[model samples]
Target: MHSRIGLFLSPVHETGQDPHLAVRRNLDLVEHADRLNFDEAWFGEHHTLGWGLVGAPETMIAAASQRTGQIKLAHGVVPLSGHHPFHVASRAVHLDHLSRGRYILGVGPGVPFDAKMFGLAPDVQRRRLDEALPTVLELVNGDSRITQKTDWYELQDAKLQLPRFNPHGIEVAMATSGTSSSSPRLVGKYGLSMTSFALPFALMTPGAPDHIGLAQQWKYAEESADEHGRTLRREDWRIALPVHVAETRAEAFADVREGYDRWLFEYFGKAAGREVISPDTPRERALEARVEAGGALVGSVEDVVQGIRRMQEATGGFGSLLVYVADWTSYEKTNRSLELLARYVSPQITGSAARPQEAVDWAVASRAAGR
Candidate 1:
């Protein structure tokens, strides 16, 4: 398993606090992550929600590029269905140039709420994504004139005027959940990296077999590689999650529980249209459920290290592990979490405090097997 730690710039609101403060705090956190020797720092893009402050990740990446050196800037996802392909490609290219090839473009079609906010119909979104992906790839690869005649969009000799920092291309990754969709296959087809969070619901449906959803994704990658007569390098796959670490498991759980209840269950749940209860569904309950279901990672330094190792083994050894350190919590607590993970958890997983690539072969071969 190739291991690296990352922080999620997910914002949480507290009473009497300015929501935009979250954005500023996240920038500070990124600087800290860089100093702490983290491999990447990610920012999420969302609209009409307090869950994330960044609505335009390209602009955020540009700002972040100037603030730090060495630490890679990632857009947890740029909603592909919400923006024009040419515009997205142009912005990313500019950031890559500005950062000197330190940008990781993570993109997805986005959630239902995102589509609704952008007034995109389902059919239009599907068609746009299919057409836009190829166009974006071409643009990133230095193709200036991309003409596409599609149902959702039409382009006539559209091209990017920016100079390419990477002629071969910088790293491109697809953001996904645990769904047996063609999206994962598309990632393999393009030989792009894959990054996903835990969506236990998808794997726990009434008729869903245990880990079936995960297996489906693995299968898709494998089959897509086979169909293309090539395998995706293992180093191109990643799994991201919200992680909290402390000196002891009890302390770690205690510190994060209140924040999880407030930010995750109360704040995010309400925003996501789920019921929130204080006592009946306490923060601990929510945390325990997700932990058992393989969603969030919370524990002492040793426990977190063990959890990471288990996940690495389960995925047949993945390449990258993105850890989210920001979410409705105090600056001190969040910083402490980042420090603990960086000091203790990261070294154990990466084995040398750098990126790991040993799992690349297995990832490629597994994707070729379609599972």
Candidate 2:
């Protein structure tokens, strides 16, 4: 099968933009992606950061599900560490039925800042995830009611009222941090899919863009699965990264200038406190570093294609490349990037389309020879 190309709408807004308008535009992006025949549209959940307007990812995803007919709608993540899994499963089932099985449930331990808002300690999130996830699985896919108790939550014969939309059950993906092995172990134990961390800076550490853990994550996942008498499939994995495509390298650079600046200056430099990109550093130099590291994609179609290839190599092999959504440029430019990815990046990046090259050559030769 061809690579699955998807959009992960974190829904970053321009400074001083209205939340209502930002949300509308983000939902509009889902429709645009659907029209382009993109494979999926995943929404993220974040409560902090003035710029991240997607407070409830499910709310937006539920709406997007109606607006989009073909593209799959996912949670990108529900931050299971802070939520009671029953509620998460219940809402997921609701969306599943509404979307008619087009829903994908993505769960994670969440970021430090957001978890802090919920009054959760950073180290305990993963432990809480470990306690809650198995019960969630039983509730979502199990035939009978489940009774489970933990320090953070207690489920007493809890069960979802709605029947699962897809008899096969909702497609589930566990989002992973580059440093954390909890996601892989949990996903492996349950035989579920995996979503690489959402952005370059946040993927590995607090705000570093090293992206040095894909191979290690999968290795740990397989080992965990083997320990559990299960197996992990490469096709069930997806890596999320920031991507913007344009006709030329310079144009692509220009398109992402504001977005990158905010990500580096406003988000990472000030709030995230990692100084991933120094204020004194040149914009082009920072962009080049991120691109060359396979952490972000901002360039021509070929450049984005190679970025994906670099990530694929890093992971050994995987299923999809989720374009972590951002509004670094105008709506027109952002939409154009998706169109370019669909029209050009989609076919060439996977090399699946390249398999038919010989046949095309024969047809061309036959036409030229008047045969």
Candidate 3:
């Protein structure tokens, strides 16, 4: 029942803001996470999306590595379809060394906007992801003189110039989405971990009897691993959710209402050609829709703890819960929320072993007091 707490930053900021400030703010948050003893922080990569301003997660990872210690730095996901495998392998290996073995190489197909930016169609992007992943794996695993050619890229005797700092080698994770995904199978085939994104919420809605459960994602990974004669560990699974905690539900709702609405209705709805809900919508009604969409986790600390518990049950279990970073009412409130999460939520979820004894003592004390 104990799950490690981490942060997942798409580095989503309002368009037109200074991109330099956005990165500085994100790095500050990463430093904060390290001080709070957060297990990891994943930085996202996007090219065309104005909201996701980080074009290269490795660069940010390298900078953040110098600012903090102990916490692991993840690529969040680098789109393999757009980059040369040799480049990806070399940069990942170099970053692993820079972080001193605290780096995770997460791969995924490029997003639609990024694909278009690179003059690739969706189908081509997926094919590139499938074909290029294994080659990157081989190069990072110390393969030399690799002579492989794909429709997208070619390698002739390609190999990493630097050895991995970790003896076990840099950890590799593939990003997957929806209830079922080919990414899980691919991750399993390579004996790598899986990071669930846009999942546990991809198509969720209120009172919808059936939605993609977190357990289903794990199931696909397990099945794929079984087929490949490899055993996938549940602890290797990481799930991301947008969570906001405060002193009260009302305060939490108020803190997130503006930013959440802008993200849901304005950015996503308009971008996807969906109808946008009115900004003047009632908070309660907005809350319902947000819950349905699996966007914000707005509540008090106890509520967030219970929400995570429900997710754990739904997933059967997972190794980590990564909080998705987005704009809040103010930067100060955002930092406070992270502080409360680490101070309050982390202990509750990770300290389950001592709960039984504490509960027994409380009951016994109540009986003795004749309450």
Query: lDDT values of the candidates?
Result: 0.71, 0.80, 0.80
Worst 10 residues of 1 by lDDT: 202-211
What's the CA error at residue 56 for candidate 3, in Å? 1.4
Model 1 lDDT per residue over 174-230, tens place: 876757566788787877788766543422232222234554676688788788876
Q: Please report, as a residue range, the 10-residue window in candidate 2 with the lowest summed lDDT.
A: 201-210
Alpha-carbon lDDT of model 1: 0.71
lDDT tens readout by residue for model 3, 281-337: 554476556555554467899989887777777668878888888775678998899
**lDDT score, residue 336, model 2?**
92
Model 3: lDDT of residue 243: 83
Query: What local lDDT score does residue 124 receive in model 2, on the 0 to 100 scale?
Result: 91
Q: At residue 137, give the lDDT of candidate 1.
A: 83
| lDDT accuracy of residue 62 in candidate 3 | 98
RMSD in Å for all candidates: 8.3, 2.7, 3.6
Ranked candidates, highest TM-score first: 2, 3, 1
Which numbered prediction scores highest in TM-score against the true structure? 2
